[model samples]
Target chain A: MSKVNIALDIMGGDLGPHVLLDAAKKSLEHYSDLHITLCGHSSVYQSFINTLSGDLKARITLEECDEVVSMSDKPTTALRQKKQSSMRRAIDLVEQRKADACVSSGNTGALMAMAYYVLKTLPGISRPALISWLPKAQGKKVLLLDLGASVNCDAEGLFQYAVMGSVFAKLCAGVESPKVALLNVGEEDIKGNTLVKHADQLLRDSQSVDYIGYVEGDQIFAGKADVVVTDGFTGNIALKSSEGIAKLVIDELKRLTTENFTARLLSKLALPFLKKLYQRMNPDQYNGASLIGLRGIVVKSHGNANSEASFYAIKQAYEEAKNAVPDKIKTKIESVLMEH
Target chain B: MSKVNIALDIMGGDLGPHVLLDAAKKSLEHYSDLHITLCGHSSVYQSFINTLSGDLKARITLEECDEVVSMSDKPTTALRQKKQSSMRRAIDLVEQRKADACVSSGNTGALMAMAYYVLKTLPGISRPALISWLPKAQGKKVLLLDLGASVNCDAEGLFQYAVMGSVFAKLCAGVESPKVALLNVGEEDIKGNTLVKHADQLLRDSQSVDYIGYVEGDQIFAGKADVVVTDGFTGNIALKSSEGIAKLVIDELKRLTTENFTARLLSKLALPFLKKLYQRMNPDQYNGASLIGLRGIVVKSHGNANSEASFYAIKQAYEEAKNAVPDKIKTKIESVLMEH
Candidate 1:
């Protein structure tokens, strides 16, 4: 409830800096104790700053950067070359202790690389992972991790992810002794690739994790586990595939509603309920994917995020900052290592 | 059209033998020229056969087996022991040329193992792949391969899947020159693990395939590519995740409609269109997933398939048999190898 300083890459995302600036303005209005450090070009910030008033003006600061990380820029290129980039500057703010957390809707790989280079991983953690929550039935949420940060994970990496994810679910979702499960093709111990099979054994042997058995993709939203862990490659595909199917269903529903008079009338009558359903199932609501296991908190928003989604990402950073997620995760991981 | 023969495993699937029997009866009723070789306990077949008359009785033949391949049975167990299992016997019917193709709704792993052991791979194909078509928008379907057949696929395995999938799209889906793509986390050449990157280069250099660039999970149903290829781990997760989301959407819709009286009446008005949409997007309609790159045709139905879904699996077997799919795939792979 004290002032939470959050840094955001204003020049990031598919839309121009104005979208991020608008989100920053909205966040400033919504959260009275929130302070924002906007990292982007000075001209964009100057024009926006001229319109702000006393308290609002005092809460906002700018770190002018000369370069922008484009969506197509490779991770290696972004890290080695774009040192003065907005994305890098935002992460740099977090590392310099000027911001409690940093958020970006820029290129995911670039943001991840920059965060890894600047913020670094915590002790007892080998790598940072991309973790995000998705809506489950009955208004609950399931946290899925390693969305795309580290592909080709070993048993050790997967075991570490399990530990990190369990901590995240407990802290963020408030699940006491969060049930963690490994994502595989089938729930059986015999299913999936060798990596998962080995990871399964490691998870089962670990006393620190409240490790449940394996869960398949179909069980991800069935509320079987508080946290579902997988390698980045499989996790990314599963997440994106769900999004694709959701879009397909929505498009089909849209087409049906406009097809005939009866459907049109039905759609009109059912508009409120439909909107509620859409809101419940909307991907935009689950916008921020935080890079956990780092020394500093970093939330990566979706690349194609709209203003609302960008605001949600900022909210995520604020919450993570308030809770000091990275510190908590570090403590939890150390305890888990002690258990070993 | 000549008489197409398909062997059905009477004792498979989550449902009992009666479901497969009902499907067999339905297939016989629909296709007058179709002959079915039923593999299961003779007592079950005898009771069913008593009701039939004339050509219907003569068209159906029984291959009695004492054993059954349970869903819990390991692939190795089914392959080594249980040679006379209903599932194995059904496959044997195809191998013996008594039936053109066979259908089983048994354990996928067991079915794959049995089919590979009995029928063996085609001359140039290293391994078999599980492939099925998903409904795309505008009444098209996209073919996805290695659904759970080969978990750890190398670049050569992927390149072979592309060749087989391309041939499948052409022969089964009736596309002239199907556009084939490798599934990845991103669409760029620089994205994904090393396996896909190597496969991309191999696919690009191949003359046999009409290779499109990489596609992300969201593009699976965008109708952008005719065939999508990935290792079994990612493919299985992506496929099941899409199914999970589809089920989630449907359940949410049902909950919304039944929430209030107005919503109920609106649902009634939209009932016809909803039914049509459900039918079009139904997973049951796309039930059978054939194990390609084998010497003979074998269709693996979902374990939890209903009567309609089981019938669709049998139908898939009939079509694959009619098309001589294995022979076509063999020919295609040989040409691709010859080109190299």
Candidate 2:
């Protein structure tokens, strides 16, 4: 394997530069042939670099960025004004061929806007989608897309999402002939609105992918489909609601275990199995979400990701870069569009 | 208290007539002031009623219906073709002022359609919404509406949902001046699409109810707002996705506890607390969802609801009937629309 370079937006996310820097350092320790260009304020990098030495320090390069895109900044505002922001500078590195891929734990809207502006869309792809991995039953995982990028999508957009999502699942999750399904309220043909119904028709007609009809919300984690496609609004709510339910269950379990000494004793006895279950279902294990349909690879880390989560984002970037996912999607999408 | 009559669609639901009859018997035992008119094939009821005796049999009335609405029947088909079906006959009881409320564990779309056609919308209300109780963290429950009734809603429709949901929460949940919020992808005002943005503006200006800005999916279970409103598409997905995630956690925990002797022993020790937690979060506990905005009260039980779940649905119908929810919503919606 040759050296792979990644652009890191150190100023993005809720935890800021410290967490990104810590993740970068930890990631470098794991991958010997990896290099990173840290895009942020030069002074912050200067203070951090003083404590590192040798191979770790030699593998990293700091690129100074004057502006910072805050979590609340509007996407249009960030695109127009924050040219020198860490997120934009990092994406620019990918466009300039200085970095293999870019990873950002920033405001999703702004990061998406900057990536699309800098890298442009892949051939025959109108808009990009945010695709993430969700843990499924029986040690399986499924890819869910359009988390919140394009809120209101047409049939064409959803069809395009299915094409991109199928390719991503194949490349990233190692699923061959991925069974793609549209996320809907029910599995019946006549269930959803006009948009989904039309998309369902389009997908069924397309020969570029294996198009299963429709899968409901509960079937998302049942490993019924390798790739699930939906409009941004529905997908985003499903993802967040799933997360919220997971949190609620964990909170309830914690409350139960703390309510009595006998319960505490039982929890202690069950600690090993509980720990394994929690580890398997940990959100950090599935942190990086690919910003697919772009000309270059861009992975978006969760806005509030910790060091371990950020490290997974970097690892994801490396995987996509190695697999040449952007080029693969470009070719696949062009063929799909031509077929339609 | 005067007798509150409930019309039950005995032919509806996956479990069929037996479950409905069982639930009605249990409910009559619990509520002495309750009377039920079961609409279905009278022959089935005749044989079942022979087994019952005394007060239980005396309080029940059986109404014969020749046609039955199958689960797969479309809403339009059910409305146009199945006039004498159990579901329609049950709603007709409400329409003719013979029953104070109606309960159906049938196809939701068909039930909503039949109810809308028979009972008609309340004055000044354009469309009815599907409102249900969702368990919150602090043993609290919030009312979420438009679960799948209206797939596409404009700003005005969402505003009406807020008004209807607020009154329902206040009357049913016993919360005065219920805080109403629109369900969006983010908490910020600028988060969702044009429809939600427009709805947010309309809600803020309305003096009919207490309007909070926006609540995201995670906050739904956090009990941040008394009433959460969204389009039917999003609301249905959120509700189902939450159920899916909850099932995943429970399945995983069960898998873990059964893995070995130690874990199994621990689960036995913790069984009491686990049972209580499970009981608190059971979907059956929140099985009933009210079809609001109609001139008459109609509660739709889960299509697959068991005996206990169906009993809860009956209890919910009894509560709404006792509180005169339909009358209250009619008055409230008329006044709110007048003010607007």
List chain A TM-scores, every candidate, in order: 0.97, 0.96
| Model 2 bad stretches (over 4 Å) | A47-53, B51-53
Estimate candidate 1's alpha-carbon lDDT, on a 0 to 1 scale.
0.89
Model 1 per-residue lDDT tens digits across residues A66-107: 999998999999999999999999899899998999999999
Clashes of 2: 0
Report the TM-score of the second chain of model 1 against its true counterpart.
0.97
Once fitted onto the true fold, the runs of candidate 1 whose alpha carbons sit more than 4 angstroms away are none
Tens-digit per-residue lDDT, B7-55, candidate 2: 9999999987899899999999999999999999988788888888689
Worst 10 residues of 1 chain A by lDDT: A265-274
| Number of the top DockQ candidate | 1
TM-score of model 1 vs. true structure: 0.97
Looking at candidate 1, what is the lDDT of residue B64?
79
